[model samples]
Target: MRGRDRFALPILRRARRDATLTRPAVSILLPVRDEGRFLGETLASLSAQTYADFEAIVVDDGSRDASAAIAEAHARDDSRFRVVRAQRAGMVAALERGRAEAEGAFIARMDGDDVALPGRLETQLEALESEGLTACGGRIAYFPRRLVGDGGRRYERWINGLVTPEAAALDVFVECPLPHPALVVRADALAAAGGYRDCGWPEDYDLVLGLWRRGARFRNVEEVVLRWREHPDRASRTDPVFAQGAFVSCKVDHLRRSLLVGWESVVVWGAGPVGKAFARELTKHGTAVAGFVDVDPRKIGRRLYGAPVVGVEAAARFACSFALGAVAREEGRQQVRDVAAAQGRREGVDFIAVA
Candidate 1:
């Protein structure tokens, strides 16, 4: 593990109490902190799930507001709602607490500020059981569309396009391939992967990567099932741990551990900013960069970070067993992949597109 323990299962502090609880078909692990304004509406969405055989395990992670009271209000009328006081633990710990308190065969994720579309649970449960997937999520839409930025919209598109296990796996190196709040995962599969952990980056992304590395089958429902609320205080946008550098560090660490092991050198395709940045991260993780490959006449002969920039043909001749295509544009990535394929480079085995 590069940062905190990867998939380290924590001992649930409330397991003894949870054992006597009624078991539901699905457990929604929702961790809320200072989300009083949105907690009630979020709870209502869960309460309205067409599949009624589900329980919402809401963990209050030391909220300074009425979030707990809001959750309590819902629990009073809905037997499916249970609130766990997590004092001051962060989101990852709170999620672990929620999982410990969960008594269902499947686990679903939700945020205090998000809304689940109608039939979200029923659709996911059916897909899970019918397709025999270890975990599955659905397409997501950012609410108050005007609040969403260009980057967020692009990310939403890229993530939702990964609708199969292979697609998700292929893009796992680039970024989190599934929407965390829209996922329904098999309980046993989750346990087998050691549940969630404080991985110093995005905890949801770390869990998804862990599960994918464990060979978990993943898929996404074609329809939108989650209304992802966007705001200035959103974790990803404000949390230092979810910063761009943290994500890049986490990805490089995982790739070094799982995929780049035993590889001495790699040819970076695309000498642009994205490619050079990824190359630097990979180097910091002890992987040697053979050089950069690019088609630009201006860059082909230059040296970046002490590595020579070569044309596509020269890159194919480099003394490296693997290559990482870090181009950001779709057309550029396709061109890079075509060049690699022409050179007999294989995806997953010999190369991967990181952009």
Candidate 2:
């Protein structure tokens, strides 16, 4: 199955039923497979949205559980609910199916296991319609404190703090800048970007990078609009497509395609684990890293993965062309920025911080 072809005839017929109701202004494409335990809560959250001018297109992706029944129950109860069935296809196909059937001007993404705060739709729709942003996401809070890991907490904090496109763009290569479930995108823009595709990486992140490469502006709603749930079975924790190395490969591929196309030699800042990992991926894809820059005296003279590690001064004088800062911490990123500036490098032009 590919693109809109993923939706079967029956599913298509089910999706197109209007019932004389007004066409929804926003379409929520939520795909679930075997999520019976959590689907009801998610559907209820959507039904409770402050903005009622939306339709929730819940695609059941071959669930062998009560997931479909739960969705059907909700559809019977609410006129805004539309359920489509799929046969074990992954997220990208399910999303495309929902998009093809969507009649709304905007598309909002939701997962079967997450909860949407009451005002999420209202706030995001207003922001997109009024600000003319290509795509926008909101803050998220992960629930069940005991299940939330340290990494998740840090990510939440970092993403919530990024309110502007510039701030998000600076670290876009480091990780996915926006949470997928909390995002609202212009339907036409998404269609123009070729909808979603599985590029051997996380679908959501790839879409975001693709949109950004097309010069799409982004922003955050500055409000916690979604309650993200953390569990061991979540796709990010279980799917190979979302593995650490896959993310690195995805970033490297996108960087080469979008930002690093004409650049020949590049300087990598930060000789730590994060920096070395990214540098390795870049080198694997034929991007030459001139050297690594570090603040640590011990690491400064050492060689990391065969690349020379040097002091900030040496890195600054290494005939810089383009630099990628791989530091993961805020302070370290700032330090890299300062050193790059001292070398007369301009950000978003001469240099971009990866993490």
Candidate 3:
């Protein structure tokens, strides 16, 4: 036993032991806050799951509206559904509380506003077991079709495109490939990854990155399992915690801890705003910027943040241990990959796509 196997053995044993217990095979942690309008629909979806042997733990985080009552109603109607009341703690605190009360081999996440497809749990569990994934999610379709914006459609396509663990890992830094509401994770893996935290960024992204750091594999099933609701009151739309700057900060922090470890300097493969912002955060974490790589002729031969902006042809001359592809556009990111490969640099080894 060595490497990940050494860490994974205990989790596997724990899964086996938990399976033998009289508990539900899956525990769905649903954190609700003033989701009165949509709670009933979400609960109904959960009740309709093809895999019926699961408990839905609804954590009501001090909702002034009828959210708690709605959940209580569901609890009364369905024996497997239970409502836990907590006073005004945020989402992370609610998740932590739900996790503490979970008694299943696998822990699934659900949002009070999202609708889980009938086969969501059954499919995710099968993938987790068959593929040996630490956590698994599936494709999501944003509902109220007319309300879903261009960005939402793009994001939906991008997330649904990544079905394999390798595809998810390669683009993990670009965005959270796993839809939080669609996730079903191994209880032991979640516990080993330290559950959820109020990390000043999106908790879902933080947890995914933390799991990746611990050598946990992730995947997305090839079918749509969640009808993700898009509305004005959604936290991602209003919360500063899910802001672009916060996401960038989180990515750079994890990048510093993982790929940039022991490296004194790195070369950013874009001189645009995206690359500059990433480099700025990386610098704050004590990593020096060797240079910025750019294809634009005008931007080349300039200096930004005390680092020279050089053309792609001259980027390899920079004295840096690793290269971060921080281009914002997908086409630009792919271009970075092509250029890096031409320079004899490997994607995950010598370079990484950060945009």
**Number of the predicted model whose lDDT against the real structure is largest:** 3
> Which portions of model 3 show Cα errors greater than 4 Å?
1-21
Give the clashing residue pairs of candidate 2, or none: none
TM-score of each: 0.91, 0.92, 0.93
lDDT of 2 by residue, 1-355 (tens): 3313322232233343353567777899999999999999999998887667678899998999999999999999987898999988898999999999998888999999999998897777667666668889999999998999888899999899878888878778878888999889988889888899878899999888989999988878899999999988999889999988888888888889877878887788888877888888988889888888888998988887677999887875656557888888877888889878888888888788886
RMSD (Å) of each candidate, 1 decimal: 7.2, 6.6, 5.1
Better of 2 and 3 by TM-score: 3
Q: How would you encode candidate 1's per-residue C-alpha lDDT over 1-355 as one tens digit per residue?
A: 3212211222221121232365777889999999998888899898877677677899999999999999998888887788998888798899999999888999999999999997797777767766778899999999889999888898889888988888888878788888999989989988987898787888887878788778788988888999999988888788888887788877787788677878888888889888888888978877888899888999988998889998876875775657898888667877888888888888888899886
Cα misplacement distance, residue 149 of candidate 2 (Å): 2.3
Global lDDT of each candidate: 0.83, 0.85, 0.88
- Cα lDDT, model 3, residue 164: 89
Q: After superposition, how far is residue 314 of candidate 1 from its true place, in Å?
A: 1.1
Question: For model 1, what is the error of residue 191's alpha carbon versus the real structure, in angstroms, after optimal superposition?
Answer: 1.8
